[model samples]
Target: MRFELARLFLLERKQSDAFERRAADGSKLNREQWLREVFSQEIDFIHRKSERRFVPDQSRPKGEQRIVARIGRKTLSHENDPNDHLKEITREQWRACLVIIDPTSHDDGQKVAIETSSIVGSGFGNFESLITTINGHSPPEPFVIELHSITDQTTFWEYVDRHKGKITSIALEVVMPNMFGGSSSFEEDAKQLRDKEKARKIKETIENEDGLEPETERMRDAVSYATRGGGKVKAKAKGATPYDSTRDKKYIEADVDSENRDINQKTEAAIEAFNKDENEAVVEKEV
Candidate 1:
């Protein structure tokens, strides 16, 4: 039972399409309201267009993490498609109470204590992909929404501003590289450096320079341990639209495994009842 906040922005893929299209009031239709409406579609839409669900079902430089919604295949059968979890919708807002799980992690049992958020799960794209299938093509205009974990991220930029130069260590999520380094430095060389200088160097190396010229890469989040004047004053390193410190908050946690959060037994019972009723009606008609 986790909650998240997200906002959607629409982008028109075709400038020509934008020129030809307008809403009822003649305002340019660029808010991706159409995509929003798609998510609000009837529950049956899930089954009608369900397919091999992907983490980000759209726009990837490489491949996506395959989201297994069932025991063996891409989607569940004799049960509900988990994508039907859209709970409420309005012109300005929508809510989805999704049940997302990582089967492998739970099975491994280091302790099944993490809650997989929709932002880091197939919940983002499962329904979106189905809508595309129903439409027979991709939406000319698509929407992008952002979600950040507020848990473990109690401190905001305001705190950082107050502390300023006191920042002891800042851990960042290295987002995109201008050019791929054959040997990338994923983590800091914590063994060699000393004091506050270590933290500064870790951040500076990625953002300031490679050797001579500086091609600063975009860091997704920065997690700082603490800021100390002399003592070990600890602060946590978080994200840009930053993710929280919890293990479940990271996308990599579920990059290899996936599961549906839907109540299988409840759905199965409903399906059974429907089938029984249908069979009875057919028998009466035959008689």
Candidate 2:
């Protein structure tokens, strides 16, 4: 049996409306600008850059790589039509999820998988339950779920009911493998060069600068002094108010002079004690 795949696109309804309005007005905003400025901020838009890839199939070799160019074309005139504006916005493919259901296994209950860009094969029972769960929780706005192989509405509803409430646990599966090489190497090399250049510039500035080292040394010394004994060195001026002694320059000078006098007295006393000890030792030796 030939298997058919269905594509579902998720869009932001409010953002799409605003975009349509802008398009109708012939505003200068482009697709990328609309996405970045308006769509990205909306809760349903799933803010991220859309990735383009080449899918490998029977027509293409497994190892073959193709670079999918970014969508750069301007919006077409037909896209501005009221009926077609929604389709144009959806074609941007910013956010989307996939639904896969097996129609032949209706007796055993159809198997269903809801897949998104980050998550895939999240099993769900029944289409109603899936819709309920998604909408009840955090629903992506303006979503379309397309089912392939099941052409009739009766078959679709039957499959949805068969798989209801029978969610299965399965490991994450990779739907597509990226085989392209060297696409990201340029960015990586450029980043490395920029980092190296930044480091070199910083090193050169440090080496060539004159006053930075001395200034840093002075700051270190000041910190050490403050931590050791500077906190106790309060200078007070004569005739200064007790509460405002710190703000008085004369009080500060007087306090400094007092501290210096105390240090000098201590030094003189130490010297005198040493001299007396030496004289006593000489007299004892002579005796």
Candidate 3:
């Protein structure tokens, strides 16, 4: 079955190649023959070779059909695999592929997985150029190309050439985001939370080491007071004195103390006056 399928793929590739050749030579080829050649079984051996080099190891369940294809670095997998008619696999296998790809990551490595629908929809070509570009620009070697589908290989190739020798083997796989089934994307979100936690810890460290808490509170209080006074605490006007030992810091402190003392005295006087008034009223009633 694999050999036959490989042949089918070869025949299809040949048709496309022949059409390209004809077009290059300015010859209008017959569409009927092109279509026939694309589906012919004569190139089974060649197709087998291509499949061995490109197709992934896939097995489908009974009564459920699927499709899988890898061109260069991009692996396109779908059911019937509607992403393309060239897929020849099972739905279960397809689902498994999604699981595998969904977990496969490019974290700190050359192996990166991206959403094919997003990339192609945004007008990017295939996996080759994308991988090559990442390999060239991103650090480390042996970058992997991962996508659900590739629309353009030529662009990928061009991008690859721009960054030569950096890229090694291309590992293509169809990575689909889990929708309703299992907890897949949950892992990524968890990772993000962990990162945020780490950041919060680092910030705490800085605050402790730099005495940020008290300093920040003081600054905030100063701003609040300035706001109450209806004036902005402008960056100490250009040439303002930074500090002065003889400056009356005592004046401000004394003013605050005096205000508190006056408030206390006023409260004591009011209490005494109220008591005296109540006593006089009681004495007059007795008389």
Top candidate (lDDT): 1
Give the candidates in order of lDDT, highest first.
Answer: 1, 3, 2
Task: Put down candidate 1 lDDT per residue, 14-115, tens digits, no spaces.
Answer: 233444434578665443334323333332334324323222112211331211122111322244335668534333222232322211211111101122
lDDT, residue 275, candidate 3: 35
Q: How many angstroms is residue 169 displaced in model 1 relative to the true structure, after the best TM-score fit?
A: 7.1
Show model 3 residue runs off by greater than 4 Å: 1-53, 72-124, 127-287
Sum up the clashes in candidate 1: 13
Once model 3 is optimally superposed onto the true structure by TM-score, how far is the C-alpha of residue 195 displaced, in angstroms? 60
lDDT of 2 by residue, 161-250 (tens): 344332121111111101111123422333354354421101011121111221234333322222111111121122321111112111
Error of 1 at 146 (Å): 4.9
The sequence of per-residue lDDT tens digits that candidate 3 reaches over residues 23-91 is 335654342333222212111111212221123224422331122223222235554555767576654
- Looking at model 3, the pairs that clash are 6-47, 7-44, 67-87, 78-81, 129-156
Give model 2's TM-score versus the native structure: 0.14
Measured with C-alpha atoms, the lDDT of residue 258 in candidate 3 is: 43
Report the C-alpha displacement of residue 213, candidate 3, in angstroms: 64
List candidate 1 stretches off by more than 4 Å.
4-22, 30-36, 42-139, 142-152, 155-287
